[model samples]
Target: MQWNDYRLVLAVARARKLPEAAEALGLTVSTMFRRIERIEELMERPVFHRERGIYTPNEVGDELCRAAEQMEQAAFAAERKVLGSSSLVSGTLIVTSSEVLGAFFLSRHLTDLASYHPGLDVQLHSGNEVLSLAHREADVALRSSRPMDSSLFGRKLSDIHWAVYGDAKSSARLSASSDFRHERFVGFSSSPFADHMSAIQRTVFPDGIVSLSSNSLVLTASSAQKGAGLAVLPMVLGEQWPGLFRLTEPIEQIAGELWIVCHQDMQNNPRVRLAFDALISGIERDRSLFVGDSV
Candidate 1:
């Protein structure tokens, strides 16, 4: 019922151990245990089940945790709206996106924004896994696919075009189509074209023959750079690393759209808004590089 209880549940779910959850929350293990007992006592049922010291959330617990997350997001959104434009805007702006955008794009824009607003602190997260925005895992998110949350704002930023890429040393082995199918392919276990939650992985092998599949675009690019395989990468990424060659024409590459999603609660915060604007502008400036039919 309380935010603290909800937070404790979240931490426990993440850590999967009482001690780990306690440590995460800076509380003693006994205190954590007592909190769980209190929740269970109020509900007249156990929310979590333990097996071999590992805690797993029961259906009720999962539902409560999810509801708690929504409540927290609403609370944060309300707080941000109340602060409005006058707020000093000093807080961690947690941004999440695919590794490619996180590693190559987000940092540069944040750096530029930092010079303008030194008081704002930024945390950028990039990985194949998408963080939960509704849980406040990230204040802002850049995604390759549209967000399903209707309350959250989602906007198409640009189309991401991908091409067969290899380093200059591997150029000799490249010949567009067969070369791509023959060489090792780097891709996520799930892609946009597949049943993955997001589409970042979907375009890796538009031709459909991935010899070597990995969840990491960075790993894919790295493998291509090392001649370990052929990778589909954005033009900007290839340009950033000299000697990486495009094996096919730009029009022949696979492309998908980019989207910017933000929790409604954090939308009005000046810091969050500024970063969102910066991201939009940055993508617009380089729109030509990504491959897709429409922006």
Candidate 2:
């Protein structure tokens, strides 16, 4: 029930090694061992099991760890509320979103917000994986799709469109069939839009070869800029990479909604609220750039 106990448990859960966790927390290995013993004694059960010198959490430990995480988040929220009620917004705000948005859309906005609220310290996590709000992985998330969690509150930022882009030199060689039948394609691995893109590619170039495939948008964009093949990159990416040109004229437009999501409980925290507004306003201001026929 103590914060120190929870910290020890969480650290152990993360490192999966007593010595590593002890070292991270600046505690002796013997002290960590005693703390674990006391925690287990107080709880009246063993939380972890050891096998071949490797320690792993048991079901009880896992459940307790989950509860501990929630408790820690609640405590942090309380501290934020007490500090926030005093006037200005100031604290660490963790925000996450897709890499494309993180790199392009969030770039200038984050810079501006820092200037506007110098007291506020913002942490940005940009990746493809959906960080869980329920698990307190992030304070706010800007994503192309909304999660199914009903406990979270979200609002639409804007609708984003896609385009088939390539280097100008490669674009010049492309033939405009209604379906873009002659263009080569570059695909990202495990794309959320894979099925849709597959159908579009099949409908367009039934026989064209797929020149490059990857999970990295940066790599895909770079390859497209090198005149490797056509890549359906975000308009923002095209703008970021001047060498890249729109290949499919009208740009293979895909209407995907951008959402700002946060746990209902954390939404009211001052730092969290400031970040939410900043994100929404930033996206709205750049709305026009995200849409239209081309970059």
Candidate 3:
């Protein structure tokens, strides 16, 4: 019936739970419930089937949700266009990166950038999930892979090198022999890089044991630091950990490319451009760190 109604239907359909949807929209569960009832009354028909705290959208709701999505996209595009036209290096800039990268590397550069520009507000979102530039979820992204979307512009930073890391004792022991079949390892529980590393490990040391696994590389590295097992970690991270030592040379087969990307429309915005250039320059200065040459 209206934009707000459309949004309510979309949120319900997406969240499937009233409380969750309400939280997303900054509304109380009771208020969300009342609003939905009011919407149905106005429409003179039921839009959702409720059961067991889950809301399933009916046909009428589905149509409204589709329209809501289109409106949302249009609104995002308009916002991007308006922001893109601004030439001043002021306003909020959201940058997303993997937790390890953000904590260990990008944070300093971004901090310096923000300090240099008093008007710039920098927000760093560190997670493994890739935020969508088209949806305006993030302004810039420092990611392990290049951008595949044509609407986004990307610059290749460097090839992220990986190596086997372990505690000093483990490193010494592993270094003494070429045989790794008896070694225990800390491996990733998920991600494409995790799968690739796992395959490499299987091929290289089929009998090696995966003693621990975690979704976060930071956790995997921590496990290795505690002598749980050897870990295959990015060289940048491995070199920085106090107790961990590289047990082997960089693994060429499992190398991942790093890229900094943003929506094409945001490239011209002064703040975005400045932040983008700062990141590129910062990463370039430490290029050896990423590629394992620094070690």
User: Best candidate per lDDT, number?
Assistant: 3
lDDT of 1 by residue, 1-295 (tens): 6889998998898899999999989999999999999998988899999999898999988988898778877776665556444467676778998877886778767776666778777888987677877667787899877778886887898777666677776577656554343355555555543344124334444454455665556666777787766666776576465567777655343566788888776677787788889988888766655652221
Given candidate 2, what's the lDDT at residue 210?
85
lDDT of each: 0.72, 0.76, 0.85
Candidate 2 worst ten-residue window by lDDT:
174-183
What tens digits encode model 2's per-residue C-alpha lDDT throughout 1-295? Answer: 6888988888888899988999989999999999999999998999889776566889988987898788877876665446545456776778898888898887767756667888878889998788877666787888788667887888888777767777887766664443555568787667776677667656555766787786777888998888778887777676577698766543444657788888776767777777777777887678765774532
28: Cα error in model 1, Å: 2.3
Stretches of model 1 off by over 4 angstroms after superposition: 1-16, 34-51, 54-74, 83-87, 172-213, 251-253, 292-295
Count of residue pairs whose backbone atoms collide, per candidate? 10, 0, 0
Off by over 4 Å in 2: 10-15, 19-31, 38-46, 58-70, 73-86, 134-136, 175-179, 190-200, 249-253
- RMSD, each candidate, Å? 4.9, 3.5, 2.0
What's the residue-level lDDT of 277 in candidate 3?
81
Q: After superposition, how far is residue 7 of candidate 3 from its true place, in Å?
A: 1.3
Q: Could you say which candidate leads in TM-score?
A: 3
Clashes of 2: 0
lDDT of 2: 0.76
